[model samples]
Target: AGVSQEFDLSQCVREPIHLLGGVQSYGALVAARRGDAVVDTVSRNAAGVLGRAARDLLGRPVTELIGQEQWDRARESAEAVDVDVDAGADPAATDSGAVARQDGPASSGVLPMTLEGVDGPRLFDVTVHRTGDLLVLEFEPRAEGGPFVFQNFYPRVRRALQKLQGASDVTECCAAAVREIRALTGYDRVVAYRFDGRDGPGQVIAEDRSEGREPWLDLWFPATDIPPQARRLYARNWIRVIGDVDDRTAGLVPERRADTGEPLDLSASVLRTVSGYHLEYLRNIGVASSMSVSLLHEGELWGLIACHGDEPRRLSPEVRAACEFFGIALSLQLAAVAGREEADELARSRRSLASVLARLTSGASDDWMRPGSGLVELLDADGAVLLRGTETVEAGAPLPEALPGLLANLARRGAVGEVWSSDRLPEVLGLEPEEAEAQGVPAGLLLLPFNRDGDLLAWWRHERPAPREWAADPSRPVRTGPGGERLTPRGSAAVYRATVRGRSAAWSPAQRVVAAELWREVSGLLTRQVVALEARNT
Candidate 1:
């Protein structure tokens, strides 16, 4: 491993990647303060790209390089780049230099610009953005003084978007998006990866790869592959591209910002250099170039349109923008599909709840506790128990003799109801593997307290029978760092099959919501019954 001797796990999370003080070598960077609009920072290659040394470029008025008209346009456009998918410009409005040789609003100030270059005149696709008071510009040379005709790519992408919108489910949406991106970008591999949760591991839900490329579809990747810092950055930006991981990085002229005393934050820069650790990670997996289009939901990173190439490949500017737009559309579609599914599930649960509540006043006081009350099935629980003083109402399954004592202990620990939940009780009680089974109690359960007499309603779930498929050895995630000692999570494409014998299936959001709704309705009915009985006695 080429890891530094000082490397440690803590450093991995704490690495200030935004302050790397460099940009990718595929382009050059120039930045100036908004106050005086004088050049304050430039990438080392600024002279080669802008035909001026970084030293000479510094302290010069920005108007000396770019016209005042262009400066104002760039500023307005940078702010106008909305993260909202609906706010994106139509493909017809894309910059012609990168699209159809006609000028339009560059997705990211991507208009063609001419400047004296080290090799004479250079036509470049310029990108502009801001980080605090500094306005930054990146200059990437145009291949053959032009780009792949967006005119041709536009029709294909239009169809792709229509296909994506027509997808009936999340799996369908992700798979369709993956194929479109692969076809559009010509990457050797493309994957639509979904996170288990905001902070959990990721699974490759859909993948499209070139012939003979190792299949990564359905593989699991550890969350550690993306550190906390990297995740935060991904959530903020819509796109990132690595033209060549092996290319030398261009260092900034001044290492730190004079005002903030920190390396200028390039969190939004299109050409910001990547982390060394990440670069090494890519090398470990033999990836030469890569790109990622973030799939966001409600401002959080839900997943990514991840692409990779075995050789150094830089996509034309418009292609990158189109992929970004596709990601935005995909995110919205995926969320909508999931939202509709959840809405349908919730509607069914509500219908069940309505039927149960309708029988409340018509049936006997004890009738609501029967197996037909729909309470047992509302949360997918195998059984239900309502303990009132010394008496107990059981449905679907018989209660253990020690039920009262267990409920009392849980109430004292505040482990009942919202404080604690199903699938966590066994761990919280520190029950041994054999003890959980021998106790004849549900391995998982949910509960709601009724009153001070230790009265409550509880639902139980017994142990499940299936084993889980893990991407790696879950217990031993430690691995050797490439060339540093790193606490590598899951990187290798391998599988680990493991079973947890003592636990039942984890409760889902649908079950929780349904249970809560049922509790509210039933508790209200019980209160009304208490008042009616008192009136009759009086």
Candidate 2:
């Protein structure tokens, strides 16, 4: 048997990075101010550009750093930008006054400003968002190419979107998106990682890499790699970049305000530094710099577009914006592809089910138990059993005599729903290994309820020794070192095999869809049959 360990709640909720309480770790310069616009804290990077240390900048006014003239120009730019913006705003934006009133901009807003650099005054793009009573600002030096050069990339973005729209499936769309993004951003590798569920493991579904790189396609990463809080942050902040992992992080001078003794909330700031554990994890993976664009589906985080570089690499704001645009386009395409595939699968299932219904209505005795019309074939199961009151009809492999009673007890205990499925029946049903083996019972079951009196259809699958190929040993979820037990990413990219036992092939989304539709049709038929029998008796 594969190694198993107890679940740790701490791994899921631990958020050391969020506690840092400042955006000083971001690649660009950052500062936070009170509602009255007094600078509360500034990053070391911003202090360097201003030719002042962090201690000198603390408790100063924003005007002092940008100069009074540039500050006025920035306010004007912000007002103009606000007017041009529509009601559909970015989710990361917040205004202190509006937040106090329980409403505001959906996300941070950007303003064009000029700031004093070591050499001379330089163009900077400033983004501002409110967190609690503080207004956080991020500053990035505007590239020399300017808006004109950034606008030039639009055609390429449009082309990529068009190609994605043309993709017939999710796999093709992801592959195309990664290739296009890697080419646009000049990253060494790009991968589309999709979460299995809200807090489940993530799998590298698609990837594209530069020459001589190892592929991460089909690799699965545990949920502990990205804790719940980090996921929440990702959903709020769509784009995150680590320009250089080796770069030193600059801490806030005071760390907290003298008056309030409260730390600044940098949740929406791009300059927020990640946790040391995450930095170590990335370092272990040999990634010097990386960027991630959150892939959202219906306003929820569905996955991420991960870009990894072997050396320190910085993407201009223009390029990062382009990647974000592509991520949005890819998200839409993924939803469309899934919808189309489900529709096609439903059609096929209806056709197959219709044939079975026709036979049932023809008054053919035992037709319900026949091979093609039986519940087994309808759900693509290895075997099936239908329980109607005291009557039981079975096909394929025989079920254990105790199975029906076990299912009935489950329904009474609220374990049954419209449809209940389990790949490992022994674990789910609490059967000992020896007991399950002695009965020669299958390891998978799907129960579809028909009525309240325990009348249901059960599909069964024989134990299949399916081998899983993992990028590393999944059994050993974490490693211990002198620094203590850390949830590090697997060091080895080589394949590790483990044969899954006491379990059958996993059920797919399409199969579940078919089972649901079949249940509805069968329930209606059973209701009609009962009505006819009651009428005859009367």
Candidate 3:
């Protein structure tokens, strides 16, 4: 048999990312300083408004770049804030403070300065941070439209929050969020892409788009689309923009850090250049410009608010700040909606289980593991089997002959949880897919152990073929390239079918909760039954 050399593009999700190099193509001008002197700089031509190329600014005193008065104020502000950046700490931990304070009040700590522009002196809003031995300065132009633009911006954010507050569920809130974000940024399309779990695939749950465009609603993208390192950058930065995909990126004058001899840490940089692979991926998807705002829940990346444009577009600093604010507001609303939904579902399941427990305690001759019983209904499984000592009672789908040995081995290896479940039993049990299918075993299995001997209750579900619609055929994920093989984004936007095998319907959160509650109740019942038998013998 010939082993195919075709590259699995999905493996790109595990590829290592170098985050701290290259200057971003965006407009923000960046320069590194040590004490009161500039060591290196990277500026766009548009930054000529600041009056010098990156090379000319190098080896110059900071006082010459910005007036002496402005430089002094920046130093004073840094000392007043007493910001600390631990070099050895995780980048994520060190960068959180900057992301958290990005949306603070305009006057809170902004260092206002006047730099010599090509025309004359122009005002700029500068933010300073200490990264290891370097003082990184990021400069943004003052709004030409003035402070009123910001005053109006805050009200719009308030209105978006009010709309979210009125939403009754997670879906409704996500829909409202995409709409509001599109309206605020004027993007051609806005989508709320949520991850299934950590390192899981993402799905476009809600979308708002311009007329005459195909919608990406409900479309799923593989986890490899955004690699782990990219996800880490999203968590640290919270907001990123590609002003124009075709624009060339500028490079830092000195590529390596002066002290560490490693790449400059750009984790907190607003002007960090994106990876070439990511840029190509966007081009394949037909996006000209893009912006992403991270939606973090409980310090973990839950999803993203993605904005795309058909034409090159750039958001002003103020506008980008507003988008970030909207993302924060939306994250809070999503958490509220999910918490409420989970609570409501758990409550319903608890009520149902309580009724079953009452009947069981009243000497009712009910087999809880049988079809239509509370345990079966609670877990939402098609069938269940109860194994007590040497006796076995099966209901719904027939129990497989090999299940007992498999369960015993799993328990011995500590591979099974207190209440373990899997939609694809073949993968979890290390069985060959073909052999699993041939054995006539159900695709789904849930085990609840009742004793150290591996005696337990088992729930089973027959295989159910679920057809997934993808933007392109996922099996052929990569294309042959001039340089051996390289990962490429799915080129076709047309819907493609993929039939999922070796799996059954997933167990819902509500079902899991009910299973845990039923386990406790059943264990108590078994204990009581054993006590009664001993009393009779005595």
What does candidate 3's lDDT look like per residue over 367-482, in tens digits? 55546666666666777777678777777666776665576665453332367778888867677656788876668887778878766777877778767676655565456665
- In terms of lDDT, the poorest run of 10 residues in model 1 is 96-105
lDDT of 1 by residue, 420-496 (tens): 45574555578864676687656777777766567677777787744646666655444555544544433335577
Candidate 3 lDDT score at position 223: 69
lDDT (Cα, 0-100) at 55 in candidate 1: 89
lDDT of each: 0.74, 0.68, 0.68
Decreasing TM-score order of the candidates: 1, 3, 2
Q: Which pairs in model 1 have colliding backbones? A: 1-482, 1-483, 2-483, 3-483, 3-484
Residue pairs with clashing backbones, model 3? none
Tens digit per residue, CA lDDT, model 2, 1-538: 2234444647446554444654434334445454455777777665554456676666777777777675555444433432111122234533221111113432455666676667787776676665555555677767667642556799899888888888898888898899899889888989999986676667788899999887788877766777766766676557878878876776654677576564455556666776776777788788999999888777677999999999987676667668866776787788889889878877777787778667766775347667767557666778887788788888776776567767775555333336778777876767764577677656877887776788887778877775656665666566565556555456236566665567777665667766776667667777888899999999
Task: Name the runs in model 3 displaced over 4 angstroms.
Answer: 1-11, 14-20, 26-49, 52-64, 67-112, 117-119, 127-134, 147-149, 359-366, 412-417, 430-435, 481-493, 528-538
Q: What TM-score does structure 1 among the candidates reach?
A: 0.83
Quote the lDDT for 419 in model 3: 71
